[model samples]
Target chain A: MDISPDESIFLHIGPVALNATIVYTWITMAVILAISWLGTRKLTSESKMSRWQNLLEVLILGMKNQIRSISHQEPDKFLPFIGTLFLFIAVSIIMSIIPVYQPPTGSLSTTAALAICVFVAVPVYGIAKHGIIGYLKYYLKPTPFMLPFNVLGEISRTIALAVRLFGNVMSGSIIVAILLSIAPLFFPILMQALGLLTGLIQAYIFAILSVVYIASATRVHEEKEQKFEENRKGKE
Target chain B: MLINWFTVFAQIFNFLLLVFLLKHFLYGRIISAMNVREEKIASRLQEAEQKMMDAEHERDLYFQKNKENDERCAGLFASANLEAEAQKKELIENARRQVDEMKKRWNESLREERDVFLSNLRKRAEKQIYIILGKIFSDLSNTKLEQNIVETFLGKIKSLDHTERNHIKVILKESYNKAVISSTYEIPVEQQHIITAEIGDAVGETVEIRYINSQDHICGIEFKVKNYRIGWNVDDYVKFLEREVNKTLEEELAG
Candidate 1:
């Protein structure tokens, strides 16, 4: 059995290949896009709205509130990146209830891609808030001798983010598959239900971690500005 | 083997594309709609508060106007009551004045009537006394009261004082020595001679005497020479009795 969806190549075109991970990722993207389009086609400012509209608003607002809480900032700037991560991962995992469907998050390549995006987003947000020199100054906090360790910690945490999501999703499916062979009737359904819950938790964890990383990088400027104001008031 | 480099790059591009599409479609529309709804609710609340303030102001104005109207009505009522009281007092005063005037006129009329009645009674009593004295003298002495009155008038002429006798002589001289002797009854030629002689002796003049019969005398005689007069009549006694009766009536009315 192919342990990763990336191993199951669907097509080969010259130098390129189409695999289950890519196909499932596209499917998840299509499903999310289609639901978003259907829910937001005729948005209203009125109190009365359709149940579908209500559900979409609840979902978007919930995501915005979560980002705001974690980042300690306005959610508008970070909503697109963080909200997309949550929706894509959640939809991909929830679709695993199908018999022949493979979740894209079950593959290490997709998780690694998401973690790399978060890893890259952290520096991009940090550099945008402060200058390149100011963002790099965060590494030499307390001492310059810890700079190498801070850099290794950053790379190692990114790898851990990818592996943590991949391990959970992959192990849940694998366990369900093994349990199906042992007791195919009730246990698989129970395990699949548990998998769904675990999958949603993973999605939440992944999105929250990304927000925390981005917030840490961006918040340094705010902290410095606050400290500067406090020091100025002390002098006065 | 589990990491596919090509697929990771593809997923990254797909995820970024999906984020752009969703930002354009879902979040933008929903947040804009919510903001518009919030602004509408806030404006409606502001409008409601303004209307409530306007209503309260109008109510206060109405209460003030009602209070003013009540005060004006009370003032008018008090003034009207005072005016009515004044009119009532004036009317009572007018009625009392009218009553007093009527009473004065009525009392004056009663006095006039009493005076007229007393005069009529005096006249009647004089006539009655004259008749009674004539009858009594005729029955007692068997002589006429006119004869007696003529004798008494002659005696009064003879008993006159010197000053009164001179006053009569002067008046007779000024009157061309003409003297008039009037009586209720015609005197006999003998009594006329005696009366003429007595008056002539008293005045020391030979006076021309004219005799006149007058019904105004009540069994009495009168002699006149110009403005001077000598008379004796029962009418004087009747007038004195009438004055006494009037005085007694006034005293009884006062009591």
Candidate 2:
């Protein structure tokens, strides 16, 4: 059984290659965009909303709440990025129940790309909130000697975020393929259901970890003080 | 291991595009619509509150006007009552005065009517008494009473004073000694001759006498000369009695 959707190449265009993972990612994007456009096409503030619009609004509001709680910042600024991560990962995993469909999130490349986006967004938000000089100054906090460790932590956390999502989704896919080879039908369906659960958990972990990193970077001074107090408490 | 660098780059690009599209199509429009609904609700509430305040103010004004009208009505009623009371008293007093005036006029009319009745009674009584006295005297007029009256008359003539005799003599002289004798009853011829002789002696003159039977003297006798008159009859006593009775009646009425 193929472990990654990238193995099923549908086309080749010079140095860049078209694969199942790319095709499925495009489908997910198309579906998400089409639903968003259709649901909000005839919005009326004065009257009742359609059921689909109601659902969409509920999802947006719940995500905004979660973002605000986790980030302790304005949810609007990060909602699009964080909400997209959750929706894309969840849709891909749930869509794996289809007989011929393979989830793009089961590939290392897609997960790495998502983690890289989060890694990049953290510094961007930190720079926007507390100028470049103030944001860069956090690495030398408590002492200048802690800068390398802080740098290593940033790199390690980003790698961990990508690997963690990739490992969970890839393992589930691998398990389902092995089961389908062994039992052929019923166990593969069960594994797919289990994969749906794993996908949702990975999405939550990835989104929360991203929020934590962004929060730390944005409120450097406040976090530094909290960390200092914690260290003092630990010594006591 | 199947890691496609191109697919990763494409996926990142697709994710960014999705975020941009959803933000534009859904989140921004939905949040704006919610804000608009909130604004409309707030404005409607404010307008309702303003209307309530205006209604309350109008109600208070109406209440004040009603109170003033009630007070004015009460004042008017009280004034009307007082005026009505005063008019009632005036009407009563006028009626009482009219009644009193009527009573006084009635009493005066009654007194006048009583006086008129009493005067009529007294006049009738006097007339009756005169008639009765005349009848009594007429019933008592026998020949002897006539002779006695003639004798009394002759005695009275003979007992005349010197002045009276001189007056009679002057009257006789002025009359040329012509005389007439009038009687209520006819005297006998002898008595007439005697009364003529006596009267001649009293007068000291030769006088001619003409006797007449007249009844106007009411049972008395009257004599007439041309300018002097002398006679004796019951009518003089009857006139004297009537005068005395009238005087007594007048005195009693005055007392």
User: Number of the top candidate by lDDT?
Assistant: 1
TM-score of chain B of each: 0.70, 0.46
- What would the per-residue lDDT of candidate 1 be over residues A6-41, giving only the tens digit for each residue? 999899999899999998888898899888878877
Model 2 per-residue lDDT at A161: 94
Place model 2 in a CAPRI quality band.
acceptable
lDDT of 2: 0.80
TM-scores for the candidates: 0.70, 0.62
lDDT of each: 0.88, 0.80
> In model 2, where do residues sit more than 4 Å from their true spots?
A177-194, A220-236, B48-255
Q: Tens digit of lDDT per residue, candidate 2, span B51-159?
A: 8998999999999999999999999999999999999999999999999899888767855775675556545554565466556656777435567657777888789
Highest DockQ: give the candidate number.
Answer: 1
Q: List RMSD in Å for every model shown.
A: 5.7, 11.0
Error of 1 at A230 (Å): 5.9
